[model samples]
Target: MFEKQQVIYLAGGCFWGVEAFISRLKGVNSTEVGYANGNDLAPTYEKVCSGKTGHAETVKATYNPKIIALDEILESFFKIIDPHTRNRQGPDIGTQYRTGIYWQEASQRDTVIKFLRKKQKESSERIVVEAHEISNFYPAEEYHQKYLEKNPQGYCHVDLNLIDDEEFDHLTKEEYEITQLSLTETPFSGKYDDFFEDGVYVDVVNGEVLFSSDDKFDSRCGWPAFSKPISEDAITKHRDFSHGTTRIEVRSAKANSHLGHLFHDGPGGSPRYCINSATLRFIPKQEFDKLQKDKY
Candidate 1:
């Protein structure tokens, strides 16, 4: 397999928060805080913070596209920054904290522009995020690198909890409504309702390993039926009384995504997890050989 690595510079308010958030992704090899799109050759934090250097505090990330695509990375950045607001992000309001996407490669421009166009349609307000080629970038001071990692209580606008799942970044409207809003898919109409592929099933939201093909069985149910989870801690069970009925609801611990209601009418009298196909991503054994390690 050909491994591809790409570098992209993004500034979303404070570099500390952006750096911390992006470093947690699956394919990110390294991240460095810097000042980008600036006039100064080697801008420092003091100069950039003054808003006179024409630079924005940014993070340069080297990522493996084979593991996570550029689109996913861009979408994750969007989720944290307010694209409509110009020259600011979170609590930091200045040119230094402005949101921008600086590409190092010409081939990446098309994808970046297309993503912005799609984001524009989804947004009602005009986008203020700057999309341009990187003219100059100067790495920030040594202390600025991984600032959040050094100081856990440091100030940051990006809430680590509110970030969207990179794995399901391009989820369809139906999938989002079902997974995020706890809506149920149509009975027996799901793609994996009767699928019995030999592989592992993971949480669509956070990429956490959830179920295995060995535990999956056809239960004549509308959703994918799993007799058991890969581990007891993989899922959290709660008493769900929604939809005018009482049932056990299962959600992924890492993502808090609603899988489906649990019933005891499964094979061998085991609890059948009638999981929604929209909330679960199945990776068959043949295709999973290369990505056996869990992303989460």
Candidate 2:
């Protein structure tokens, strides 16, 4: 049987770096550097660089859907590019350097647009990445093809290591990155934020029980809020001043994976334990005791 393939175009800063970054994905069949969403049918590197061709440096990613989902690809794209910055990514500047996702197929078009809207809710900064129907795309010159692979030391604002498939027990790539890499999920985006099932949440990286259902509360933090950990020994705290503030960073004791942060404000006498949903896996109360004592 012939293999099925899907194509999508992404323009995030420099095409050279963007092309190289995506070329490493698992399902990717091929990637080509190009200029897209411009009026000029014959846009060249020089003409686009002149900032008058109305072109954006773009990367055409062709991949097999049977291996990778469209939503996962879109999430991977969002992880590398800063959606809030307008008309620029990294040090590159001008219209050619702007970040965007252009689509052709109706299914891909809806997927891209839906992903963007979901991503926009996660950040306070305004999303500047454009989502548009495919207008035009001109393949870049041969020398620009796989420029980073040839140069090896070429410039890339993206951290390609973020997507590497590293097993974290039962965690997915996105879950692993969010837990081990300190990457935060969108606020109010976690499954347990408003969930009140009568069970507990355990560290995804390890089966160490962390938070009990009784302690879970609604803080409107968009994450699973707990009044406290199941016990003081269940978690560890470290000094975290990232994003320009001082706070206690929470991590699972057994897994040493980032859970979230501790805040002083809470409804009653307890401090609010704001946690990331990706870092914790939930166990329903009914099955909590049914599991083998050694497994949970």
Candidate 3:
């Protein structure tokens, strides 16, 4: 048996756009637009828009983990809104339009903290997004439920094409690409240089696990470098006698990313794996346990 009902509150820009965007998600059982972090009994749209109430336009979403995970939901949330911006999304400029995550339970706080920390490090910016406990939820009027559905050509910035439900799956396409593909292209450089602190650097394209913390050494090569992968089976090594000397080209069994070349010349008694920073996603030991449990 699986837990079918889980609730999460999101406040991003206008409630109309947020409601419209979240309603289309696959696992979403229901969505209700409301006012949160305010003292009013039943805040009207006009009252909230006044900016004096301190109420943010929020959406309460009910989803199922068998179909979607909280992490996936959070990831999707990140893509839609700019966390770097303060108290605004696009042209809507006000505190009522602020971004926030209202945690329903105490257990979720740690996960939120971890996600926020990783996000802050990746962006290297001050995160203005708020994470707080739910005090009270005042549901908006009936017209606010599916504003976009009611008015197709309404003023909304949410592009539905970017929101893919498949990404919410436990092993997402991004994760699959990392595990199976040899993705060497840096989508955003200087963003994930700190991800090499510890643990193994596996092939981002295939699930072939490679490289370990013990084998990792600071080469100051701008990207992560490992003495050697965990095993030869973890990577498909190819002989490249290009230019002048013969060298080993490291590739993932699942896809191509041109992860840096390997060399026999390395410290200790191990091969050197010079890999690109963008090709890997770090999984700390603490989070690894949660990932394994979620998979089963």
Candidate 4:
């Protein structure tokens, strides 16, 4: 049995707003606005605000995953902030107000990695959200906790109207970085680049498998290239000329992300399915075999 409450640390912008926003979540048992991710000893808010302490205003949330999955919590976190922007959230600009995810367990790290990869593949732009292992977390001054609840009229830079449930379905902060903010590449420098031998590379925004290793090949373009999609109906093509060159864009029929361009040139005059490495998840053939066996 899983624990009734799991803790997650998130830093989007002002601690007041983050705390207020998450407090309204159904599964959230409680929210504490505090400071995490810093190298100072009992740093004060003035020092943190000065951008010298490296402390980010964060919210430590206790929630029940049975009521709200970690993914859903992360999705809501992304919708409220600009993940592509570094060291800033809304009108709050500083390292103390930056966005981040601090993981407490190995499983949590893996979950974040998987979500990041899927998000990159689902967006044309890159993702720039930073993720790090949790270190020492120092709670903020006592007055900071639930500050918004105590003083509803307090000045907050966050847009309360921006909090919506629909956007949470498709993108987390990691997805927003790639899809909306156009921040390319994973923040950890592609540390989790591995083609697993199981599962399928479904669309990050929607569950759709556009390609598999069975169709992947070496185009020698320094990226993963597929000869064709798993199913013809799984992908859609559109005219794109954003780079001063006219080309056909490859997109998932469901989760539309700029997968890369298609070229008429290929081995034996076949069309080449050139795709970005950041935009794909490779499930090994062995995993596919097991899945096939279980389908009966």
Task: Estimate, for each residue in 1-296, the C-alpha lDDT of model 1 and write its tens digit.
Answer: 11246899998999999988887665554578889988988787888888899998889987767567889999888888899998878777888988999999999999999999999999899999999998788888888887876688998899877654665667786676566546688998888888887999988776788999999888886788888889987876766543446777776767667788778997668789889998888888877766755533
Instruction: Write the residue-wise lDDT of candidate 4 on 1-296 in tens digits.
Output: 12345788988889998887876565554567777878997887888898888888888887666567888888888778777788877777888887888887777888787777877787777677778787768888878876865687997876666655474455565553333222245332331233324345655555567777666555655545568888877776665433346777665554445466688677897878866545555455677668778987
Residue by residue across 1-296, what tens digits does model 2's lDDT show? 12456788898988887776786665554577889888888988999999998999999887667666878878888878888888888888898889898887888887887888888788788998888887788888888987875677887787867766554546787686566556678998888888998998898876789999999888887888899899888886765544447787786766567788898889855699999998888999878877756465
Better of 1 and 3 by lDDT: 1
User: Which candidate wins on lDDT?
Assistant: 1
Ranking by TM-score: 1, 2, 3, 4
Q: Lowest-scoring 10 consecutive residues by lDDT in candidate 1?
A: 236-245
User: Cα RMSD (Å) per model?
Assistant: 15.7, 18.3, 19.5, 19.0
Off by over 4 Å in 4: 1-3, 162-296
Task: Write model 3 residue lDDT over 84-153, tens digit each, in one string.
Answer: 8888897899999999988887877887878888898888689989998876788887777667766878
What overall lDDT, based on C-alpha atoms, would model 3 receive against the true structure?
A: 0.69
Q: Per-residue lDDT for 32 in model 2?
A: 78
* TM-score-better candidate, 1 vs 3: 1
Clashing residue pairs in candidate 4 are: 121-279, 126-183, 126-184, 127-183, 196-284
TM-score of every prediction relative to native: 0.56, 0.56, 0.55, 0.53
Better of 3 and 4 by TM-score: 3
